[model samples]
Target: MTVLVINSGSSSIKYQLVDPESGEAIAVGLVEQIGESTSRVKHTYDGEKHEYEQRLADHGEGLRFVLDLFDSVGPSLAEAGIVAVGHRVVQGGDNFNGPALITEDVRDLIEELAPLAPLHNPANLRGIDVARELLDVPHVVVFDTAFFQTLPEEAARYALNREVADRYGVRRYGAHGTSHQYVSHKASEWIGREDLKQIVLHLGNGASVSAVVNGEAVDTSMGLTPLEGLVMGTRTGDIDPAVIFHLSRVAGMSIDELDDLFNKKSGVKGLAGENDMRAVWDMADSGDENAREALDIYVHRLVKYIGSYAAVMGGLDVIAFTAGIGENDDRLRAEVLERLAPFGVKIDPEVNAVRGDNIRAITTADSSVTVLVIPTNEELAIARQTMDVVATLS
Candidate 1:
């Protein structure tokens, strides 16, 4: 069966049409700058790619554009017969610990939780509504936070007034659950152990680390939002949040401006004036002191978390790296493994050189823990969840 997965962001919509039976993507692309006059879409299928620029007043219009492209590109929309439409919903709150069918009640619940993910939930709802109108197929909402619902209460709760936190929904709701969950399951299989203790380092444009015990998320770095975690491409992760108040009192900046800076202007971006790690590494290699410092801070935080997770899990059996930076950057992996030597982690330089979408063991055979580079597949995870939803309905 085929499934269509949609991940809607504030100004972009990424979509993938997958044949889950074969575990291959039939078509995938992104429509960016929605609500902007210069909006554009780039789509690819069967080795062919096409780009288009036009106005997209909102997600509804952008999704319509996607439908037209699917028809014009190659596949007959009917023949593709998307059995389900899965969304990458950012927050599901305590009520939804798993994927759920999109009903009016579900939509209302999502709306109520929007403040927790203001930059994401509204856009996600827009995609859901638009997809529902265009396709009379099953629609499922797979939350990014749902995967971490397994976090122990001690790990999930904050040290605050219980009544106040519950009233305001101000508790830890880890992000990157989808990526962490995917990598953990894949790591378990790679390690050939069903009950595995694993640490998943999902380093990328936006970074987070997770500790999974026996396929359940025990603890994760990100809290409430993606803004809390290891240093990211453009986010200041795990900072004294009082810095927001300090910025307001000292610089007289508004809350929106502070949010913009911390969520979009900080991290390695603020330090080196760039977010792409490749660019930062190149500058660092050429004697850019600030860029070099950014790299150091990024890797240092990752190592710190790995060590913390090792302690949390009593001992880690496997460590998996995934996402854009983690799976491809051999040097970064080498450095992280070097720091994890206390845990007997070692990367064979030859094994690290191999790169692709496949999973591979990067550590030497004798290491205490198996180190792996497993590419994350969030879209496929959404698709599988969507398939499950459809099966239930049928």
Candidate 2:
């Protein structure tokens, strides 16, 4: 049996038909620029790619077109044995601790929580509504924030006024919890220990770190929204709250403009004038001072978090790096771990330099902490969760 995983954004839908038992994505596709004059659709199956363009009015039309592609192309869904459709919802608030079957009530709850994730939940709900209408399969919602529901009170709450915070639903609801949970569990399985204290750095265009103990999340970087946490590609992570007030007063910047600045024009792009890590690295190698400083700032924030989490967890037994930069950037990994030399972390340069898809240790065998590079598969995680939720109905 297969599960169809859907990660819908404000303007695009990314999908994968997956075999949960074998962990293979049978087909993968994306529909971009929905509700545009010309929307692009790309589908790949059997090692071949098919691309097309059409004028789509909305998500429903875009999805219908995708269904047509599935029918016209090979591996028809009717024959593919699709058991469930997993929708990736960004914010679950404190309402859901795990994947939930999409009932009318659940769908309404997702809609209710839209204020918390203004950009993601509505689109996710759109995909869910359309897919449910068209597919006639059991649908499941896998939340990015669900895995972080286990965070302790101290980690989840902000220092602001409790009344206002509650009224505004302001708290540390982290993004990338799915990735952190998946990688942390894989790290525990790989290390053969369930009680290990671990830190997972999900470094990508969007970066976040989490502290896990015994396979449960204790603390995470992102708070209130994804705008908090480690330095990101375009976000001003961990910025001073007073900066907003100062900008409003001195610069006369409206909230919307300030939001645009911090969320879109800041971070690596703000510092180095380039958001892509590879471009930043090229500039740094060419002795561009701004790019070099951006790299330093990024690594500095990482080191700081690692030290803080080590203290919070009492001690650290494992450190797992996943996601794009975490998995591929050997140089950044080396720099981050090397800064932790005082903690008895010793990474084997040879092992760290080797690039592969499988989980492997980058630390020396005798090192105090077992450092690993585990590739995160969020799609497979969602698929398995979807299957689990569907199985409960039977």
Candidate 3:
């Protein structure tokens, strides 16, 4: 069986056709610049890439063009036996704890929760709407917040005014829960232990960490939104609330301006003038103080989270790193583990330096904590969950 996993962003649609049982991405494609004058579609199959440019006025148009590519390019959806279409919904709020079959009511619920993920949900819903109209197969919505639904109250709730918090649904509904969930399960499987105390650091352009006990999430870094956690590529994570007030009063910034500043113009970019970690490292090598400081802040925040999550879980059995920076950047991993050396963490420098797509351990055999670099496959996770919902129909 195959599943087509679609992740729709504000102006792009990223998709993968996957065989969940084997975890192989049979084909992958992306449609960029939707609603723009000129849009680009790139599809890869059978080790070949097909690229094109056209005008895609909206999500419906973009998806229609994608379907056309599938028909013309090869690996027809019907020939591939696509069992279901999986949609990645960013925020399910407290309404869904697991993947839900896309009924009209579920679609409505996703639309209703858009305010919580203003930049994501609406775009996600657009894809869902267009896909359902374009394809007759069962469709499933997999939420990024579903895995974090298992978080304990203390970890999920905010310490705010009770009435105000409850009324506003103000709680820690984490982002990137899908990646966290995938990595944690992969870690457990790699170590051959289900009852593990795991701290999963998903460090990419967008980063978050989670503490999982056994297979359930106990605590996560992101709270209420994706903006609440680690020092991301362009996001100011863990900023003091008073800074907003100070900016408004002293800097004369409006709410919209402050929002733009915090989300788009901050973090590593604000500090180093470059958002990419590789660029920061390059500048640091050239002795750029700003770049060096950004790298230091990024590593420092990661170390602090590792220590805190270890405390939250009472003890740590495994520390798994996944995502762009986590799986690729050997130096960052070395720096993180070096700071954690006091806690009996020891890295096999030789093994850590090797790069590949497989899940492997970087820690020494006798290290107290088994540190691993596991490649996260959120698309496969979504496809599997989509299969689960499809299975229920029979």
Overall lDDT per candidate, in order of appearance = 0.89, 0.94, 0.93
Any runs in candidate 2 off by more than 4 Å, and if so which? Answer: none
Q: Which has the higher lDDT value, candidate number 1 or candidate number 2?
A: 2
Q: What does candidate 1's lDDT look like per residue over 1-394, in tens digits?
A: 7999999888899999988777799999999999887998999998999999999998888998899988889576688877888899988988788899999999899989999999889988888888989998888999989988888999999998999988899878888888888889988887778798899999889899999999999999988888997999999998997898899999999989999999999999999999999999999999999999999999999989988988999988888999999999998899878887876777788999889889999889898888899999999988987888888886
Could you report the Cα RMSD, in angstroms, for every candidate shown? Answer: 1.2, 1.0, 0.8
Error of 2 at 337 (Å): 1.1
User: What digit string (tens of lDDT, one per residue) describes model 2 on residues 1-394?
Assistant: 9999999888899999999999999999999999889999999999999999988888899889888888999579989999999999999999999999999999999999998888789999999999999999999999999989999999999989999999988998998988998999999888888999999999999999999999899999998889898999999899999999999999999999998999999999999999999999999999999999999999999999999999999999999999999999999999999999888999999989999999999999889999999999999999999999999899
Where does candidate 2 clash, by residue pair? none
Instruction: Give the residue spans of candidate 1 off by over 4 A.
Output: none
Instruction: Report the poorest 10 consecutive residues by lDDT, candidate 2.
Output: 66-75
lDDT score, residue 108, model 3?
A: 94
Regions of model 3 farther than 4 Å from truth: none
Please name the candidate that would achieve the greatest TM-score relative to the true structure: 3
List TM-scores for all candidates, in order: 0.97, 0.98, 0.99
Root-mean-square deviation of candidate 2: 1.0
lDDT of 3 by residue, 12-107 (tens): 999999999999999999999998889999999999999999999998998898888889996899999999999999999999999999999999
